[model samples]
Target chain A: MADAKVIPFDDDRSRGGGAQRPVRRRPASGGRRKADAAAVRDAALSPLPGPQTGEAGPGPDAGPAAPAEPVRGARSAASGASGDAGGAGDAQQDGAPVTAAGETPVTADGGWDRRIAGGLAFLRRRITGDYEVDEFGYDAELTDHVLMSMLRPMYQKYFRVEVKGIENIPSEGGALVVANHSGTVPLDGLMLQVAVHDNHPADRHLRLLAADLVFMLPVVNELARKAGHTLACAEDAERLLQRGEVVGVMPEGFKGIGKPFSERYKLQRFGRGGFVSTALRAGVPIVPCSIVGAEEIYPMIGNAKTLARLLGFPYFPVTPTFPWLGPLGAVPLPTKWTIQFGEPIPTDGYPPEAAEDPMLMFNLTDQVREQIQHTLYKLLVQRRSVFF
Target chain B: MGKVVLVTGVARQLGGRLVRRIQRDPEVDRVIGVDAEGPGHHLGGAEFVRADIRRPAIARVLAEHAVDTVVHLDVTGTPLGAGGRTAVKETNVIGTMQLLGACQKSPTVKRLVIKSSTSVYGSAPRDPAVFTETTPPKSLPSGGFAKDAVEVEGYVRGFARRRPDVAVCVLRFANILGPCADSPLADFFSLPVMPTVFGYDPRLQFVHEDDVIDVLRIALHEPRRGTLNSGTFNIAGDGVLTLSQCSRRLGRPTLPLLLPAVTWVGSALRTVGFTDFSPEQIRLLTHGRVVSTVQMRETLGFRPKYTTAETFADFARSRGPGLLPPETLAEAVDRVAAALSIGVLDGAPVEDGGPAVTQTTHSSGQPG
Candidate 1:
């Protein structure tokens, strides 16, 4: 038999000097044969295997010699549903379609597909960048990003974080940011970081000294890293402060965050003046900050220590609707967070060896405590809402 | 006609004496004695009511008695044993709370007299300016830190604020000493072998039991309303003496064994349950503490009947020879050296001649 010549799909010469070739036709069997021929013809006319690779492939363990007919049929069905063939015909008459996948032919500004693409790209970068927490100990991860995103709208709209006396935060030196912890979950610390970053003239990152339990969670562990939190160790605080970094600490810590709702604003304890000792040792200024609105967010009505121990948490907080509301109650009330930074108490005058003097440490601690208490009363009067 | 007064812990040394003193006052119509262990063996005159002040129900009992004045003297536990600090706080703090609550409900009650210790002052710079009622107490590191001092004050302050008609007086007392004084001072003096002193020149102060009773009597009758320094005075017989002088006065030989700084030893001793005095006590002892009684005398219009010397003599007479006689100066030094050789007082600093002794004959006894 004479060899039939192969013709390229887009070869100009094969199309007989610029004349277009006829579309491939199928034989009519006038019955099931005709249906089968129609199916084959439809499969051949569909777009090639690309983009949706997994769906086009044959079932695993299937013989490699399996006919390409079934795969082609699946591709044809997908292309038809998407109207790709119709678009292809238009492109054949003109040039290739000047549009992206799933995009409208017109370059409309409000196209959903374009917006989705841009959003996906942003999400990709957010998931991969330095802000992305991944490692076991430290990394930016999804929950942190989600939380930040969830809080961004509210932070920008109703919550106006104004950092007063920011110059009190050493620009190049380590500083101990002794803030009052209020809310059951300590969202105040989070807002503190945001406030420092957004409102500080230097846009400095405030490394928070968190409790032991915060880093103990699987998911929250990574999130904490991205948020730049470390264990609330005197050594860690001293190191960071000595390095000239701004360090945030809650002297009240677990006691403050877990205090009974009746004692909401009353600071429980300052923990034996460790913070003061750290500040004195590092010779850094202690910036006293008071956060209002957090106490109202998740008022710690009670605590279940047994359950907390079982769950490896410090104290299982029982707010009004928490645990009863389950996951929903975990969502903090969108309280209008107002963090006010008081003037920094200069440790410059304090002798570096003052850390050894328990009396001196106590005096300094009392001063810081008095400042926070005084500011809290003022901020409480100034706050407008329990939740926005 | 006289006013009725209720006193708790009336069986204890200070409490028993206070009850006796209150009974002798012609102005006291009837004295009510309350204690957890029934009436104390020696308590007399006052009606006995057995009740635990820690229980809230006692407050009701107090109200039922139609008590007009309350002299709170019961503390949960003394600072002498395991959980002593906690026990003391519970009794002193929580018990005070219940008592104050009772006073609040009783319409007949006109005054509350609280016996607070100068321990709240901790170790402040000894400026020779005696600690006055106006001076804020220095915060302490121990569990007692301002717990009793501040909370009792708060309760009384709050009570007065709520009912301006009632008068609340807090008496900040210095170390109380005398015959049968069951305080840590008595215990320290009775030790088989005295603990090594950090230095040789620490000053000591003591107030006679008679003076304490007199102050209590005055507080009950005096129309004063605010906080006051009651019995604390520089009761060192008008002069400060070195440790050697104190040992000599007690007929004990001076033993000079160097121990680590008082702060370190005091802290270690407190942790190991060896001493009742807190780290603050060591600081106070090594540094010396003296509060003037000018206001206590002028405001209360009372004078101390016994001098520091007379008080010490009475204490010695009461104990007789059963109280360990002071070791001979050379013998005391040898005993300390032996104890140090066995590492019993490890990390103790070396001393020159002997432990610092005060001229006051109370002796360096461990406090109960």
Candidate 2:
């Protein structure tokens, strides 16, 4: 229950990089303070470092507390602190032999050593194909270690996303997260993914239902699949829910993301309420999520239809900086984001035949749409400024 | 009387393997292997008949043998022997039509087993993550082996409808991989350096060749079990491996080219007698295909022992070493892992020297 130490991104990296240096004064003197911090932080976060965390707590003060102990203890603790338990567990198993040999007196060198070992092990697994991908081509390991890390900086330091009502999502079983999609490039969907992953207590992954266009592109298609984004079809949605996965769907589609900035927070038509029917058929609850501030990131002032046609894009945005500024214009504004998950509407109460009832689908879609729209307005009023 | 079974495409490795396997089954009285030419490999005790399924002569052979069950394995995705694409199409489509036509007239033939490919559900951007047997393909195959499969399945359906008494079983298999796999995918992996589409890393699924033979053998005797009540089922290994993962596992370096360039390279490789990387294969590589085998397990009551990764691993072992040996790669990985654990100390520069010595010793211990 201890709060995670929120270190400034730059400070965290600088200290981490310094640990890889060959020369140091004395192991205990140089490493004591940071090692103590890591031990305390990780002990509470992960279970793999339990023994090591206990051992490491007193080592820094004792100075000569088992020369072989500190390095293994710190290494496991440091990696374990990264929120990747699998990698941390592997590091613990690997470091076991080194500790037994009592060969090295490497102190807080834990930070970089753990990273390098975890990275090398990851590379080995990838080359040897010693990994599992779900039937949806979702690589959980890659998403957890690589993709999440890559997106974390932007989600944390840049957007500073504040998630509210995350408990509305069930800790286990299938749930449909219907969020209003915005941001010209659809970066909201990714940030939303990160928000759900990092903030949720149970750490559930959101299997996003992406439009067909995402799969039509080359590199995008590959990354999309690895990141667990399947085609936004009823079959895929129903299947994911059936398998007890949290499926994320943006009913607004391109209309919400591609519309001019003037129409920012207005919810678009919820695509024939197909998602509602899918949820009903799967007998899961629908969690309506409203995201504010993503619309301000690109701020599309105009649309170049001809250029969009030429490039085969849905709409080419002539943002304040884009087209004229070229590649540099693509950089999004650092807007503060607030994503709130509303109370889940249970569809399990409906009869199985309710999925076929178009009238019910319409009413449910409208209810979800209105809840999201109301929350958006409420969030916008609460905010002092767009970028704050 | 024991069942009389006629197996087509026996000249191919899979066909020959299936024929021999069925011949050993006690329920089958006689197994007759039919093809345009005699099988180069042994077919155990099964009788060999040199009759192309594309011709009406197949009907005469079926009548003379009083064949009650026909196992069609002639649906080929690649050209065989001296035949070209046209020949493959003829063998797969026209051949299936003639065979089914003959079976329709033969009242004695009450059971038919068709070996189909999951490619019938063509890979496309809009495709569902996993395909069930009844899922309609998002995009029908435009041409080549996939189209031939579609046509063949169509003909089989018509034949089944015309003869309700006939129990037809269609086993749609994923790509097959094994030690003795002669599949196009096997050839693709055997290349010293595999060429892949630049930006696409498709998730590939494979069924072990042994699993395929086992399923076929079961399908051959399925009517007696009564579980094979003329149903179509998907047969694939449990897991999936991305194309990139497969190449890495094989220790084969990849040459990632543009989509158009991959097609050009494929044809060039075909012309050079290296491998037939067909258009259908190119699309598969672009948008990988995966089919659910739940029905194969629950309905057909079969489970593949080897997963997709395991099947590919078995095939990679048979291929020997590629540009980089897997053992050396594994050793390097271990060395790096050990060094990472031990190397990050105040004595870092000196620690670097230790791995250099250990690497040399590791390499010396390994054979070329």
Candidate 3:
């Protein structure tokens, strides 16, 4: 058995300093390295496996020349050999024959792992910075408080936010905040997060499910992460909910955020019950929140999909003057925001396999959407201002 | 150049005349008449739509007519102590709710003229001062006490808050009268006997029906976007006239009576069908009240075309041979006096300077 190659995980030497020692990479035969690379490709392409610890390896100071036990559970290496052998042998049951160069066969099929690694690298680049409390501070705790404090004046002076049924939000565990999305910029979600943390009894931090474009921006990606927003993916949603955190999602999605000003407060197309399925899988209650006043903030005049694609953004919103004037017009008018939380839709009664039932998921999603929509209309009528 | 206007409750006297006046207005495009009882035979030229507003479905019917402005004049509740006045709650409160709901759905409805009442202010103190838009009504235990005051205001306010783009104007009226007036004044004059003061003086305000129509027209043409107190004037013909003076002006003779005894006897007579005055009416009569209309005059540019004296004169002239003779007026007065002696009306304790009592003029009515 040959030792697997070791790669240094953290290479930002400035942060690690002099205390960090160099990691040793074991030199395998050409056939073996090729085999190991092929195995890594196979594992990367496979569906996410169940929780398993990585095989124990040699100490950090171990020499590259040292012979060690083959890394158990490195299924990728065996899968690669099986591929090279045209599926002749059971890669898991018996070690595949090594090539003449004494190294594992190297295949160019490790594209998915490289892409995922690249994404992770990109995330790291976006996050590493001296994010001070000046010019949009990035401290998660402080940012949460500041976002709320910034909204307090408008919430109090203009709109009387009557938050009902906040007890629906789970205290310790992950919960999905499935709220009606209004307004052009999804400011309702931002205000909702603030409302939950500032006004809810437990003051739980809400992890928002933002769009992919949000995480693709330079400064915005980092800020979103600090604010606890990840890509609005079911995987991330399930992960957060399973961890007992409050995950806020605007099921109305891009349609709700990009609705024309004429249909400003109306609920748009909900994305095929994805949020409901996610909640069902996680077995979390869906808190329905209806937000009034956010619709009037930017007032989406139209959308430019061509420009959005050209700029690598989702639905380029043409507010009063948003994209034309850039950041100047992008500033949302300080509208009085009233967010009311309706009774939670309990998914605890439904089994996790219920997510597989499309019809059931659709009906449940529609029910939630309708409740939020009706509540929004009622609240809008009750609200007294466009801008506080 | 008449602008098209739709007036609901057009079959009612005040609403009927309003439809006619709006139809005659050169600025009005046309008058669209809507009523539950259908258009009065005299309401010619104007297109009429028959719909009972108590039902929610009427909202959709009204929305289809493409009415540019709506003057809602239907009253659901009868006057205090009138049989089935409580039933009026459904029509006045729920009807208005339905009407406003319809207005929200209609894109053509740019202006809403709500015909509210000074009753929303409830009974006021004896200040001879005018009640303005800013005066908040006092809270009362009775359902009607707050129903007219709060529910109506809530509906209108809610509409304005939800739909700022729509221009909504509320006209809080005083007692309206004219040739077709069927108020207590007509009943009092027609009575052979009239009841007089027991211990306190009572002052009543009335706006001529013609003047009410005039104000509605002003609202239609001007379309002010806030609440306005309109058509509230002393019905005494000159200034604040005493209850006895009002009876005398109507050619009725009044007999002074004991307050408690009058109330008790009035109640007894009311049960016997000899009189309409309840013990409550007796109590209210003994307590003088007034509401200001200075804001209506200043903001809406309203000047009453007909004074109270002229209003009564016009009514008397219209009755012609059917008018109540002086001798008949005396007999009616006697019957009213006897009715007062019996307790028919039950009066609530009057507060002198409460929020409901204080009346505001034009200056106080201005929005901040």
Instruction: Provide the clash count, candidate 2.
Output: 1
Indicate the docking level reached by candidate 3: incorrect
How does candidate 3 fare on TM-score?
0.39
DockQ of each: 0.01, 0.24, 0.00
Fnat score for model 1: 0.00
Question: Which residue ranges in model 2 land beyond 4 Å of their true spot?
Answer: A1-107, B223-226, B340-368
TM-score of chain A of each: 0.63, 0.75, 0.60
Worst 10 residues of 1 chain A by lDDT: A1-10
Predicted candidate 1 versus true structure: per-residue lDDT over B1-368, tens digit per residue: 68889998886878877887778778888888887675435666678888878787777776787888888876422542335577777777788888887778878888777777655555433222134555554444354534566666677677778877776667766666677787765655554444544332344456677787877776777555554433332222222322333343454333333435445655665676655655555454443444555566666655677654455556656655433243333344445445544222222211111011110111232110
CA lDDT of A330 in candidate 1? 83
Per-candidate alpha-carbon RMSD to the true structure: 29.9, 9.6, 32.4
**A288 in model 2: Cα distance from truth in Å?**
0.7
Lowest summed lDDT across 10 adjacent residues in model 2 chain A is found at: A19-28
Cα deviation in Å at residue B251, candidate 2?
A: 0.7
What local lDDT score does residue A294 receive in model 2, on the 0 to 100 scale?
96
Query: What overall lDDT goes with each candidate model?
Result: 0.56, 0.77, 0.55
Q: Is the docking of candidate 1 incorrect, acceptable, medium or high quality?
A: incorrect
Task: Give the docking tier of candidate 2.
Answer: acceptable
Listed for every candidate in order, the interface RMSD values in angstroms are: 36.3, 9.8, 39.9
